[model samples]
Target: MTKKVLVIEDSMTSTKVLQKVIQKAGYTAVCASSLYQAKHLFDQSMPEEFLCAIVDFHLPDAPNGESIDFTIEAYIPTIVVTGREDEQTRSIIINKNIVDYFTKGNSQFYEYLSRLLGRLERNQQIGILVVEDSRAERNATVALLQRHNFITYAASNVADGLAQIGQQNNIKLVITDDDLPDMSGIKMVESLRQQHSKEDLAVIGIAYQGRPGLSASFIKSGANDYLTRPYCHEEFFCRVIQNVEYIENIDAIRRAANTDYLTGLPNRRYFFNRVNAILQSPPAHISLALLDIDYFKKINDSYGHDAGDAVLKGLAELLADICRDYQLARFGGEEFCIFMPLALSEACQQIETLRCRVEKLRIRFEKQILNCTISIGITDIYEGSIDDMLQYADKLLYQAKQQGRNQWISSDTKHRS
Candidate 1:
């Protein structure tokens, strides 16, 4: 799949030049002579198409940058191309918060556009909550963020900042000035970090004056990084971008560790970790159940190992599908586990749904018919020991086998020991 570039230009020469540059740089080039044509192409193209866009200010449809402005409004990462390069013109361009800008040059705008495209390719969106008591400073930080292409929200103080943080789940970065009329920013960062879950997130403390080792204190108070007031734009952007990317990388890594490979479910390690969590309290009204296949070993032996593998996978799928509201896991070979946070009787109602679904699964392996059923051993939390619960369930499973397979034995009633 080639990365597609959408170039909206009215100039035939410049359009041809950009198309050639794009091809040379190894990206497929698409050209639109007017905004209508550009929109039409966008509507026709696949949703996943078009990595980035370059829009010319003046077009045949309407003059004075209509196409470029509309493209930016459409929420695509767009670079504005125009012959005007005066400070006033640049101010207007920057005010639109365009991702990048390309001025007409002898080298052609393709490489410059490609630089922004490169950034867009690796670019990750950073959610930044800017905390400022003064409206002036808040507007200043918001402008700075627009120049750097960061998604930002503004808050007046500690309370507002926390509220915005709660509202935006993607918030990876926070910038707060130290001298709020109420609640010093350093104290806010400390309090937030404690409640903010040590998961991937960054905080940078900003202050107008140097107040005796405040930077060190801020870092120690659970901020990832910090900056003094009256700083350069590049310095601020660098620190903010770095911290956001760091947290995002950590989040990606944690996800890989906890997710299961085969069925994309939470694997046994995570399941047991949760089980330990559920075991912290006495098993008063809580229940646990261990489900096993009726004749798993014989199914594999008679229908080849692949069929056995299919049964196990099919059972796991059915378990996950039916027990959508239950704590479930691929416990091990030929065995799966479910934990219901309710009394034995209520949990039985929930588990029976899964039992009936699996019992009806007629898994086909070539000509051989593979019908399956499962037996479950249920027990209460009863003083909160996983060891005791496992023993009780194991005893019930043995009982089910003795009484004949494909039957559920409730340890809460059938075997109290």
Candidate 2:
């Protein structure tokens, strides 16, 4: 489901900018210029429908934080955009149960709002592993994380920590104490580093006072960060937030590297790596196809490169909708590839279906509706290599283009309906 955010600000320029930023971050923004408008919008929509809301401290009608109070009254996770940072204003906003408040004094505050929204969005899927031998300490740590909307798993010892990490997927951050029942925290960090890289998972060690060289030891053992015991709750949250943000940024970079920019599909590098890995233990029944858009250059030459891009994106969406069970990739330009885990006959039928779907796909490109079709070449996996299968599929693809466009050719060079 698409996430919706409510934006209530009186400044037209600021409202437009905030709306643009929110939408660019992949959210639907419902904007209102006044407290009355905000109330009407809130009443019309279910309160639970909004993932979160952003409200200005001063509105035209509600000049004194009334809008913030009203929005919070709706049980929405609210974020305040206040031009004031006075002690009394800060205290009142903090007590209002908002996600967070941002000062609009800085020029980069809007960008920060976008970043905060993204963090809250990702918090739903992020899991933090808390490993502490002291049950009280473990519970306290979990409570703090949970207050910030993080899913937490607790383990009493290093061994249990490792076990929990293995069992829980999407566990991105681990908070561990210096001492553990089964093993030293430093040793556990070292062991964890061997299994998970820093880009995907982060480890922060918490040490007590009088533990000389504890922080250094944890760092040397591959922990990303260390916090001393009896620390402030705000300090602990900041450390955890920074580490999680680092992991998320690195993961995003890795994803971008593995994906095609134009079509939002896996790129050739990912395709080759996955296919090679699969061939190591080749499945009994497998199939692969190399698909290409027919007369793609003509589309670009006649309409524009933008139209070609639209056609490619349209085709990618169609393929994604239909090829849920297959590994699909945009190999470059107008070429795409799909790997099917089915028998020869089934694979052929699936490809024929995809071909018909592509034939019927129409994309509205500035001033005109563009119809596009694709030619596909498919082959069943043999007792040979991935390269061999790809070569066979490419050959069949060539036959498809040679005989006619907008059709598929299997190993038998026969078109299936």
Candidate 3:
């Protein structure tokens, strides 16, 4: 379902601003001017539809943060925004069961809110493991994570925590207390680092304030971050978010490096890496196909370059859809490759189907209805290396193009039109 955010604010200006921020963060904003209006609007929809609620601390009719109470009572994670920046206002909002509170002091507040909303959405997919012997502490940590919509797992000891981490592939972050039953948290962090790099998984170690060198030990042991036992909620969240974002940013960078910029397909380097990994075990029957768009330069000359790009993207999308069971890549301009663990006959049939589909595809660009065809060369011969397979496939592909456009040629069989 497309999640929504409930914005209860009396000011039209603030409501409009919040709506823009929420929409930019990829969520719909349901706005209300007062608590009564919020209730009426909320009654028309299900609570589950809302990702969270952003409410003004003081509404005209329901003054003094009553709207915040209503949202909390309705079980929606509430984020309070107040013009009052006093310590008492901050205290009152922080004590309540809310996601976070923001004081409307500067433009950075909305900027942070935009980021926070995005984090809440992403947190739904991120699983966090809490490892603490104290049930109370573990529950509290889990509760805080859940308020931000994270998938949470709990373990009472280091051994159980390690087991959980191995079992739960979705777990991206581990928050562990220094004192554990099976092993010290620093030791656990060190053990975990042997298997999971910092970019793959993040660990935050918690040590009591009186523990002089424990925090530094945790850091040296490969914990991404360390938290003090008596830390405030704000400090705790900052550390958690910092560590999580570190992993996510690294992932984003890796993906960018491996992906083709225009068509969003795997690039040549990534394709080789994947095919090489598969070649290590050597499938019983392996096939590779090199495809080139027929008359690609002609298309670019007849139409605009934009239309040519549209054709490339359309072909990539088709390849992704039909070759879901195989590895695919855009090997450069007007060229693509697919690696399949299928016999020559099976691979030939699939490539023939793909060629026919490309011929039938109608790519709309501007006022033009453009169509293109692909010539494919496929080979089931795997001579130890992916490079050898690619070269053989390229020869067959050239033969297909030489014979006629929109046809598939197999190394072990006759060319098909």
Candidate 4:
């Protein structure tokens, strides 16, 4: 199918160029020059027909971003293009989570736009792998996916197929036939189901010698979608497409849950989850640190909140550069935390190194320059649970603040068993 994209851009010349580019990229494109025209186009174009949309931040009708909101409410993935870099535009773009914002004059505008569309198109296809014993059945399944333009892979029976699965990354959907020499497909599906969440990996079973409603057993065996022998090719392909889409949606949501909005780090909830997991079967034992910026409150009060944000962002960059392997998070206002499994001593040393880099970080605002200092509280996990480790680190961090505001305090306290 030729992919359909509705472009709501005000510049007729730019829209014409975009139309040519999108068409050349093999998508059927529609261009609208204003909010009212966009509404008319949307009304005429059915939702199922258009794959997604691109919206301009300021249309002639709604100059302050009202039209983009309307488009997003329609459940289409929309990318925002804007001529203005105002605070209001940035806030709305962040709040609505529109896709991404691009200032039109940024020399890379055309490249970014092209990349966004490509990502959306690839996201639609969703990858699948089919495993069957019969050459004809396997080819039929592979043919069904290829006809739909879905990127696909196929393997014969249990052993060869599972080997393929381990080697292939992002193999979201799997179709397996139950009978095999190495192992039964039911057992394969069960093993995968036990190892991965239904949302992350979808398993569908196919059988050649089952009675009516036999697909129910496979569904019970943990397939997100089911199919039987003698199935219509169209129905089978549609089922495969639906499962792939479902798993991708689920993967997206899971990622969002694991991420933090402000500093773009893993949030505290996700941090604790890793800590708990480490305590269960921790290797060589890891170290945890409770790091806080000293005099942060004074900085927040002296400069505006925006500068304070700049400081936090600057520090986050520095930390990521120095301790790339360790997991870090903005623990709370003016405080952050890090956990490094194989490098507790090294993590402590790195945080101390970061403090020196952070102190030299001269943040410039409007006309003034500002410098900041950070203090770290470090503890290695040699005893106790994750909670106790945090408590130990927090206590040490409290001590670091006392021993003058810019020092790192590494305590010999044990906080996990």
Candidate 5:
């Protein structure tokens, strides 16, 4: 369901702008011009339908941020936008349990607001671990993170922190204090580095204000960033977001490297890496098959290359849907591969079903409805190397093409019509 963001502002111009920004961030905007209207609208709808509320710090009806209080009391995360740009105003807004506050000064404010909205939506899926020995400080940190919609885990010592990190795979960032019961924060960072790289997991160390060289030690021990004891709300959230974004950016780059650009499927390199990992502890019965479109080039020659690409994309979607349980990839051009950890008979049945589905698939390009079929070569040989298995499958594939264009050939069975 599309989550809604309640916009409570008095100015018509600001309300329109906020509505556009919220919609651009992939959310619905529910607008209210005053505190009373906001209450009425909110009462008409369920509170769970709202992701958060963006309220004006000063409204005509409620001039002292009463709407902000109202939203917070209703258990909705609130973001304050005010025209006041004084230090006193900032202190008052930040003291409340709000997501963040913004000054209506320039275009940059709205830009940052857009980014913050996106971050709030993404934070729902991310987990963070806080390691601090003090119960009060730990609880305080967890509460702050919860306000931003993050899944939070707390540990009172290094041993518990390490255990939680091992158990929780979604934890992307770890914030640890300098003093812990089991070990020092620097030592904990070192231990964590042994198993996870800086790109895979981000660590932030916290030290007192007068701790000389402690920040340096944390960085040297593989912490991505560090924080001081008297950190404010803004500084703490800034450091946490920066470290988390570092890990996320690296993940995006790695995914782009492993994914095919055209069909959004795994490329040949990623397929080999995945199958090789599974091959380490080889399955009792494994089968590999290579599939090729029967007359892919003819489509390009008759219709155009665009039509050929449409057919390839259509087939890739079918392969993804049907072979979701197995390892599959597009091995360049018209060739695709599937590795199934099943017996030869079972693999044959699955591949034959896929073949029939492809035969019936009609891809529409411009005004033409094009139909295509696939030829498959399968083998269940337990070869030591993947290269050898692929070579065997390729030979069978060639034989299938020679005998007939739309048929399958297997090493242990006769060619089927």
Candidate 6:
């Protein structure tokens, strides 16, 4: 689906440039030349239709940031652009909850605006925690974050802040004040570091001016960065966004390391690591399956590696869907593994279902449809280690391939027909 951006600039030149930037970023732009037009366009569009809004602070019809007010009121993430950059104007725009006001000082500033919009677009997927004892500061910080499309969790004290962080699975950044009612923010940051690593979570400590050594203490206590109170809006966003993006980049690297590039499935190393962990703390019952494409090499020889890749990708999709409730991974090449917490019979049924699906899948490549089949072997986790379970499953898989290819063999086949 194409994302839509709202542009409310009275100047045609700026409007055209901004719209081009938005479209270049693969988004559609809803252009409005005045405050009245912006409201009319917004009224016509759905509440969730606009990804975000770029509003001019001084619209012809509403010169005093009325357009900004309307966008914020409608809960649209907004970035304000204005010709003025005085402290009074900045303060007013900051208090109005604009993501970050931009000055039309130079062409480079607009380029920065485009990048900021891109960051704000991604901010929707990130969650941030604001920890401040003062109600006003907490609210203000949350407002700013929300304006940039961040999901925010607010805490008035250190304990609640930690609890909130623990509860959220996607929160990667935390902004906390140095003075908490119960404990020092430095101590809180130190405590959090014990549970969360810098790669997983980034913290920023906010201290008031004239507080000597506060920034130093916060950093020593494991904060990724520090900010002073009464900070500029631009500085605050820069620090927060940089830290969040750094953590996200680390996460992306980790995912690339653990994922299979061709099929986007977990790689052999990740699959084995998870299985080892499960073995360390055994569950009620664990089932392991090893699957290999029957005559996969023949496909590569007959059609070419490109077609073979298509078959692999198609089979990966089917297996992922079939084993949606279980742990499935592309171990390597035409091989896949499934770790299911199910009874022996149930696991066998699921594996057989997967085999049938593979048999029926017709993958299309360059105007030709190709057919494929997979043979699977299953074993139940009993008193053996993960390696033992894998070796047993692999043995059964060999049995299936030998018993004429495209079938499944379970370790406990004596009971079932």
lDDT of 3 by residue, 360-409 (tens): 99999999999999888888877688888889989988988898878888
Off by over 4 Å in 4: 1-120, 124-127, 143-151, 179-181, 207-211, 228-237, 342-345, 361-371, 412-417
lDDT of 3 at 236: 86
Most lDDT-accurate candidate:
5
List runs of model 6 lying over 4 Å from the truth: 58-65, 83-96, 381-385, 413-417
Better of 3 and 4 by lDDT: 3
In candidate 1 the C-alpha lDDT for residue 398 amounts to 76
lDDT of 5 by residue, 1-417 (tens): 999999999999999999999999899999999999999999999998999999999999989899999999998889999999889888889999999888888668788888988888899999999999999999999998988889999999999999999999999999999899889989999999999999999999997888879999999999999999888988999999998889989999988988888898999999999999999999899999999999889999999999999999999999999999999999999999999999988888888899899999998889999889999899988659988889888988888899887888886766454
Best by TM-score: 3
By summed lDDT, the worst window of 10 consecutive residues in model 4 runs over: 408-417
lDDT of 1: 0.76
Clashing residue pairs in candidate 2 are none
- lDDT by residue (tens digit), candidate 2, 150-237: 8889999998889989999989999998778789999999999999988878999988788869999999999999999889665787
Q: Can you write out model 1's per-residue Cα lDDT over 1-417, one digit (the tens) per residue?
A: 887888998899998988887787778888999989998998888744766678887777947777767766666666788888778876777667466676786365566565556555544366678999989989988877754456779998888898888889878788888888769989998888877744566888885564758888888888888888788655776687677668767877876776566655667787777878866764457777887898888887888888987777777777778778767877667777777778888877777766788878987777876888888888775555666777787787778777776777786664421
Please, what are the lDDT tens digits per residue for candidate 4 over residues 1-417?
A: 687888989888878877887877778888888888888988987776775677788887888888788777776666778888878777767566355567887888777567557756775556678888788988877765653445688887777777777887768888888767788787888878776778878888885544655577777778776776777544674577578768767877876888666677777888888777766877686888888888887888888898888788777777777767777877778888888775666666677678788888887776878788877778875676777878988888888788787877777544211
lDDT of each: 0.76, 0.86, 0.90, 0.76, 0.92, 0.87
Q: What is the lDDT of residue 373 in candidate 4?
A: 88
**Each model's TM-score?**
0.70, 0.78, 0.94, 0.64, 0.93, 0.90
Per-model root-mean-square deviation over C-alphas: 6.4, 4.6, 1.9, 13.8, 2.2, 2.6
Q: How large an RMSD does model 3 have? A: 1.9
**Candidate 1 residue pairs in clash (backbone atoms < 3 Å):** none
Count of steric clashes across candidates, in order:
0, 0, 0, 6, 0, 0
